[model samples]
Target: MHDDPRLEELVKQVRASRKYSAISEALVRRIGAAELCKRATLQDAVKATKKTLHQIAGLYLANAHPPYDAWLRQIIQAPDDTARRAVLRSIMNHHTSTRERLPILDAFYARVLADLGPVRSVLDLACGLNPLSLPWMPLAAGATYHAVDIYEDLAGFLRAALAALGVAGKAEARDVITDCPTDAADVALLLKALPCLEQLDKAAGAAILDTINARCIVVSFPTRTVGGRQVGMRENYAARFAAMIADRPWRVERIEFVGELAFRLTR
Candidate 1:
């Protein structure tokens, strides 16, 4: 998180914007002006405050690096707790607005569920602290969900979130680039993970796609920035993905851009 340039730019934008004015002022008053100067960004300060609040509330979930932590800290320090809670609750109900590129995740779920009828199980690849594909959990009501990811801590975090949401799913420790299970998945989801491959080569990403022997695969790439920040354009992903499945029997069903993200549904 510290090395991400995108994060750095986002922090700068947040500091200069009116959105975080009240929270920033509250933090400076509570934490002191001198302490705020020591940190690189206000987001960092918010993170520290949220840690304290979470510790106080004893609300520990398996989900590590929860984005709500920052929001919670801002809300708690506000003058009115009721209004703060209401605002934060509404934010949580929506997809993370902080993300640079946001695809309509719910629509993708609907399409996937309708496409893959009566699937036995699902394997969600690169599942981070937040499980974006959670809605599909109901489709395979009794099926085992094997969520795999490089972030080892994410497994516990996802397990807790699933439990809290009353979703029955299992988490497995896996690095998609290095190791992908041979277990057949009825459907596979590769969503917004291509940008996280800082060290891995393009071939590694392609390998994961090749290994997922599912009936249908739903993959998406961010097309533009939702926050008006600079990000690497995913210009060649479609061609690369198409090449991987060229020799396969699957047929491409949909390829369209939604907001700043491009989605492809192949069956």
Candidate 2:
């Protein structure tokens, strides 16, 4: 049999990079799940694996719901802070993971922003309705925020919300896997997004981190899966994330909160 150079090289790339080790595991998980999803076929395993991979290669996030767009629009039209916060609650309750993280949003934002002094601009990657939490963030007056998400309708609603609130925030539909946005900012957020990005493309995720022009990058990961499973996720993700930055030029600081893990990186 002839040697397959491409597969050999891919194996070398996966084995040599510790950061990619976690990504490789994620791929294995996907393949196993996909395989089981087609187990009735009992034939053409390669075809099934290939088809499943293509379907997911460019997926951005798992918890996307277009039905929330109307709720976001209502929040933008809210008459007062009391009304807006109430509207925000409805939006938050739509997703359990986001809902859990938001009640402590004030303290969470304080910790992420406090360490990165004097922020004038922000970049929020894969920003779900988290951009709606802008009211709670300790942002400088007139600080410009640029955010992106794959859900165009949700992003459009956020763009309208930013204008309604008189904050200099911009939300646009984007696929970070294909074209990661890079604008200079005092701080850039990757909250609970790295794993998803890596799952899409580890090379793209690493490249996004390497190329983004920001003073600090804040990364957060969930301690519990969306299904409420807590099978060593924190330790597993943290070790892989540390490996991702092992050769990069940044000072790392870790912040731990119940059911969540965070890191502040500055250079």
Candidate 3:
């Protein structure tokens, strides 16, 4: 019997949460039917049960990442274009502010787009709300802008955003893990997505780089953890990222920002 006061309080809170109560009951039913391990203390037993129930309903843990779905819901309900734009900006990751993310975006149009030779097409992969930042990307006339994400809701909102912003672009929902992206564009943006992809599958990041046909691919990673901890994450990701693309003959141009590490990989 582990008589921890902290454990007792945690169990009480979980029991009181309506969202978790049904899930907890389902778990207890399974455990009881299977004759699972017994805890001497009832409170301790509840705490352990709560943890198992939480894992079973882990989809509710969307609170950990960017609130994209919630923001999208709010956007659809917003009254006007201005209000929708505000909702869209609210979901931008911590790297960027509610308005413009970083100072680099000011010169981004000139640096990435204009300097990349003839970019009549752009492909944004695992692109969150970046298409909303089209104002920052000074694309030439009649350029085909394509964005992709896993969530269908994101695709719907992004397509609406593009039309509202008067940008000639299309957004598609895709599961990059299962299906490979077949879009061909002059420039592809894979911003802060490698680490996330790697978490699902170890070789997915490299596979995506190889599959996407783009003359110039711009890849980025966060310099610090979401908690703002610079615990050697930058150097670690940098080394692995560089090694991942080393096989290809990519002329990598590195850009170091306070929040993110970016590379413009071209042949």
Candidate 3, residues 1-267, lDDT tens digits: the string is 234444444545555665454232323433322222366554555565556544432332333244555655676687886776565555554223212344455565466565776677889987766776675676777777898865455577678767666678798866665565777889898887787667546898888888988999988887776556788877888899888988888999887766677789997
**Tens digit per residue, CA lDDT, model 1, 1-267:** 344444444444433433332222222233323224456766665554344323321122222344554544454454664564344344444433213222344454565457557866777776543353454334655665768754334456556555544457777656465567767878776766654432234466566776787777767665555444445555555666567667766667545545434444455
Ranking 1 against 3 by TM-score, winner: 3
Best by lDDT: 2
Local distance difference test scores for all models: 0.51, 0.69, 0.65
Off by over 4 Å in 2: 1-69
Model 2 residue 207 CA deviation (Å) reads 1.5
Regarding TM-score, does 1 or 2 come out ahead? Answer: 2
In angstroms, give how far residue 131 of model 1 lies from its true place: 2.3
Q: How well does candidate 3 score on lDDT at residue 53?
A: 46
Off by over 4 Å in 3: 1-104, 107-110
RMSD of each: 12.7, 9.1, 9.5
Q: State each candidate's clash count.
A: 3, 0, 1
Which has the higher lDDT value, candidate number 1 or candidate number 3? 3
Q: Estimate candidate 3's alpha-carbon lDDT, on a 0 to 1 scale.
A: 0.65
